[model samples]
Target: MLRWLKERLAQQNEAVATAVAAADLVDKRYAAGLATYLQVLSTQNATLVEKRQLVDLQSRALSLQANLSRALGGGYRPEMTMTANAHSTVADKS
Candidate 1:
């Protein structure tokens, strides 16, 4: 799942870069009078929206990684789960 999230984040980052480049092209075209100002503004707005979405995805990915780390006890160890179970069983007896 962590690997999947990392891959997804990478894809989103690429999308953000593509949107930024597209917006830059729109700006250049508008300056040359080949595209309307409204068109440029629309492309820029799309870029902003994509950037915001990318940020959200990044945040979720980080959160998921953190949760996974916590779940695995920072890093999985062969004896960690058994140790935890033993501790819980001992505590319940009291």
Candidate 2:
């Protein structure tokens, strides 16, 4: 899961960079061509949302991995888990 998140984050970074470049182009075009400010803003927002989603997904994947590690009696994995509390609630507490 970590590997997958790293790969996906790399891809998203590239995509975000491209989107920023495209937005720059759109900005320049707006001054001299048919491209409008609204168009550029819309694309920027979409890419921003995509980047945010990538981050959120990575967070969840790490959480699940951490929970699995603890449940399997391994080390804490040095990361946090969203399911840790829920799982503990169902099981007996020492």
User: Per-model C-alpha lDDT, please?
Assistant: 0.85, 0.77
TM-score of each: 0.69, 0.58
> Which digits, one per residue and each the tens of the lDDT, describe model 1 over residues 1-94?
4677779878888988999999999889988989998999899899999899888988897777678779876885445769988999999999
> What is the C-alpha lDDT profile of model 2 across 41-85, one tens digit per residue?
887897788778777877887788788788878776444455776
The candidate scoring highest on TM-score is 1
Q: After superposition, how far is residue 41 of candidate 2 from its true place, in Å?
A: 2.4
RMSD of each: 7.5, 9.0
Predicted structure 1: lDDT: 0.85
The candidate maximizing lDDT is 1
